[model samples]
Target: MTLADILASLFPAGHAVRVTDGLVSGDGPLGASRLAVVGIADRTALGVDGACTLSRHVLDVVQSGDRTPILVVVDSDSQRMSRRDELLGLNEYLAHLAKTLLLADAAGHPTLGLIYGHSAAGAFIATALATRVLAGLPGADPSVMDLPSVARVTKLPLETLQAMARDTPVFAPGLDNMVAAGAVHAVLDPDSPLGPQVEALIGQMGADDIRDRLGLERGGRPVAHTIAARVAQDAGGG
Candidate 1:
């Protein structure tokens, strides 16, 4: 879906968001309230500049003191892979963006991510993965790393990785895999109106990060939650 289509689905009532240089910002109606939107579009590869721009917008929202719900819509490539970006400290910029989102959530502004198109790697992490809850639209493609890259890094054959992905949610690039792995909190039903589903997810939002528990409950990463809890308990932090 185009960004326009996504906005339409998300706010059937109406919206006033503007997309400039692939950066999305503005407000939209959400039931009886309003939501602040900060996102990327046009399949942007988040470089240092884009990351800085997005972080500023999120910080503006955080400083607004409204506690408005935030929706981050993502349609981006991985972080820009360029020597120039590296020299410009792209990692720091990306981290800043992710931290700003976390800050928004921490400041009582419920943050959610809606992945309507492809999102991968650092771009995904600094946006969708940083949200309090992430929802994927049908056919949305999300990847932490692509198979060929994983294959090259692990010295495994492409066919082997593909076969492994079929059996496990890890090492794959699909909405279902992400959902099973608990990275995606929900998958919006394509047949239903998106507005209600989004509202329901907003209503269900809590302050805790529960992806590890969801992974265990969904049988994806079955031991992750237990191990985390054990470590926390051992440290007297649970």
Candidate 2:
């Protein structure tokens, strides 16, 4: 499904949402408060400008001294690969965006990532990875790099990589694999109306992030929780 389709389904009939330059900001569900949604459409790459705009929105919510939930809509293939962006410290701008979201969360606002489509590389890091909870649509996939690109870089046969993906989700590129790896909290059903799910999640959001535990319980990820708990216990004993 397209980004517009998802938004329309989530915020239908006088939702008062606004989309400009591929950034969304306006009243959230039930007209409770302000929120932001950023997506990449028109094959647009999220560059420094988009990053700065999103960061500004988060800062605005923090300055208002109200808890505003920020929803990041992930649908981008990659960040804009431009020499100018790189020369002007694109990584730093991305870092600034991530830190701003963290500040917002600290200020009582919650950040959520809704993966509706292709999410990868630097774009995913700057947008979705910063959020507290990450939910994905059925077809959504978040990966460090697409398999074709990985194979090209590693000089491995494409068939070999594909076979490896079947055996190890670490090499896979799908929403289920992301859930298995503890990178995605859940894979939402595409057929169901998403509004209720989104609203319920927003109402139940808390500071405690449970993706690691969830992955272990669901048998998607095998050891992240174990290792993390062991480290936490060791640190506590020290």
Identify the leading candidate in terms of lDDT.
Answer: 1
- Clashing residue pairs found in predicted model 2: none
Q: Per-residue lDDT of 54-86 in model 1, one digit per residue for the tens?
A: 898889988987888899999998999999999
Model 2 per-residue lDDT tens digits across residues 126-238: 87878888888877767878889889999999899998888776568788887777778766666787777776677777867787787787677778788989999999995
lDDT of 2: 0.76
Over 4 Å off in model 1, which ranges?
none
- What is the lDDT of every predicted structure here? 0.90, 0.76
What is the lDDT for 66 in model 2?
Answer: 70
State the number of backbone clashes in model 1: 0
Best model per TM-score: 1
Off by over 4 Å in 2: 31-34
